[model samples]
Target: MLIQILLILGFVLVFAITWRRFGQNVITFREASLWSFLWLSGVAFTLYPGLTERLASFFGVGRGVDLILYLAVAIQFFLIFKLFILNEQSERKITNLVEREALSHLNEDEPASANRPSNYESNG
Candidate 1:
């Protein structure tokens, strides 16, 4: 009973944080909604573990704990993939910005005539 209470408290705290983040504009509404759903689901499962067992059997999983572990791993992998994609995109944008800034600086340091074609013909 104490553990269940603790788990519920933890889930509520996390749910509050999710909403707070959304309120502070640190996270989007969609993200907050998803997180809220997850935390609420956690609370539900903690309050009634039998639900998980029923779900597990329904899904052909041998045990409720096993189902939770499988889901946790899957969610972790999905989030990791999302982070990887975001990191790659950020790197690409940073590289492009750096290249552009370098080229602009180079142009600024050079004389205007340096970028133009020469009009004089070469004598044979």
Candidate 2:
């Protein structure tokens, strides 16, 4: 059907983007592989939606759509959690670097300032 064809195309597009990201070093090999697998799985499920129904039934869910929605939400939450952790780590690193550089600059300027006459001292 037209819908299946469109779904397949969309999945292919996702796979292409994942591959491009991996090639460009924007994502690691493990990340690309996981995403590629997910896209391929999407294509497979779209091609045979009955599988989702069967899985849903096996898991005691009333409908395949519901199961998919639940899974998508859970995945979204996990990804958000991971991004939060990474963001926190990045902020800590930036703060530490800024503090270290400030201390180093202060240390380098101390001896020079010690030998320099202050404007008030010079005027007096």
Candidate 3:
């Protein structure tokens, strides 16, 4: 009973954070919805752990704990992959911005002297 209560409280906290993130536009509506669904599913599983056993059996897993562990590992890998993709996208955006800025400066009406090597570069 105590465990169930704690689980519910944890779900409530997650729900609150999800709502706040959505309200602040930190995440899209679709992401908020997905998070809410996941939290509710967690609450369901906590309230009825037997359901996991049944699910595990259906999936040919030996135990509920094993199934959960597998899921957690898969989720971790997926998140890591997503983070890698996002990092790549960010790098591309930054590179494009730098290139654009450099091109714009080249097109500006600067004197030839402005294009001279920097003092440090000349010294080197």
Candidate 4:
């Protein structure tokens, strides 16, 4: 009964994530990695009941492994959010660097081009 509920929720989460990740350019490998992880984790959580005993003993959880899994999922979500923030920050820095480089080259050329060789001259 309880397991069935968990299974349903797990499938729902996977479906939602799949739909969301569709038709988008994953600019960063982090996005791709996270998507894969979520889908895989959703499957694991859905199938957790069967491995409850094994995981329970492995983790030394007396009640069961469900709570541990729930905690793990929550932590994973937190980590994903952090990864997203870090990725955004990195992209912003890259954009700024590119813009600065473009401007620097433009400024350097205004005064330097007049004295530079006109590569367009023919050897005729």
Candidate 5:
């Protein structure tokens, strides 16, 4: 249980920092909120195995614990998928930005000074 708390806290801290940094153009608030929910839910589910088992049985799962864990895994996977999508979006944006910059540099005239070696080159 303690371990779960620490892990959850760690994830939340990292998420907060990442969300703040990438939140600008990376993910919408709604998406982030859902992402957070999925992660936190998994953490909560993992920590309370007994409760999860009971809930699972209540829902017709033969083994409540196993069912709960499986559900948690599924939920976690979904969140990870969403996170990956956001990550891909950011990566593509970066790729596009870099490509645009490179193209612009290619299209524009080079600075006149860059075309020739400096006077120091002759001295060497």
Candidate 6:
């Protein structure tokens, strides 16, 4: 009972924090909603562990704990994949910006005529 209370309190605290971040504009409404749902689900599961057990059995899992573990791992992998894609996109944007800036500076340093092909006849 004490553990349940503690877990519920922890989930509520996180839920509050998540909303606070949303209020502060640190996170978008969609992000806050997702986090809120996750925290609330945590609280719900903690309050009624039998729900997890039933779900576990329904899914053919041996135990509720195992189901939770499997779900946590799956979510972690999904988040990691998202971060990886975001990182790759950021890298590409940075590279393109750097290339554009370098080219612009190079153009600024040289005369415009230097960038154009000369009309001189080809030497045999």
Question: Best TM-score goes to which candidate?
Answer: 1
lDDT of 4: 0.67
Give me the candidate number with maximum lDDT.
1
| Stretches of model 4 off by over 4 angstroms after superposition | 1-6, 9-23, 27-30, 66-70, 73-124
Model 1 backbone overlap count? 0
lDDT of 4 by residue, 1-124 (tens): 7876777677667656655565355335576566667566556655665565666767777645665667689888999999999999999999888877775575356674366544443232
Give lDDT tens digits, candidate 2, residues 6-119.
Answer: 999999998999999999999999999999988998998998899899999999999988989999999999999999999999999998888777755654466753764333
Candidate 1 residue lDDT tens string, 26-68:
9999999999999999999999999999999999999999999
Q: Positional deviation of 95 in candidate 6, in angstroms?
A: 0.4
Worst 10 residues of 2 by lDDT: 115-124
Q: TM-score for each prediction?
A: 0.83, 0.78, 0.76, 0.40, 0.45, 0.82
Q: Mind sharing the TM-score for model 6?
A: 0.82
Q: Candidate 1 — which pairs collide?
A: none
Worst 10 residues of 1 by lDDT: 115-124
lDDT, candidate 4, at 46: 59
Please estimate how well model 3 matches the true structure, expressed as its whole-model Cα lDDT: 0.88
The Cα local distance difference test for each model comes to: 0.90, 0.87, 0.88, 0.67, 0.72, 0.89
Q: RMSDs, each prediction?
A: 7.2, 8.4, 7.4, 8.1, 11.3, 6.7
- The whole-model C-alpha lDDT of candidate 1 against the native structure comes to 0.90
Candidate 2 vs candidate 5: the TM-score winner is 2
- Writing each residue's lDDT as its tens digit, candidate 3 over 1-124 gives 9989998999989999999999999999999999899899889899899999999999999998799899989989999999999999999999888877775675366687777433332121
Where does model 6 exceed 4 Å of error? Answer: 108-124
Q: Mind giving the per-residue lDDT tens digits that candidate 6 earns over 1-124?
A: 9999999999999999999999999999999999999999899999999999999999999999999999999999999999999999999999888876775565347775676533434232
Q: Show model 1 residue runs off by greater than 4 Å.
A: 105-124
Error of 6 at 53 (Å): 0.4
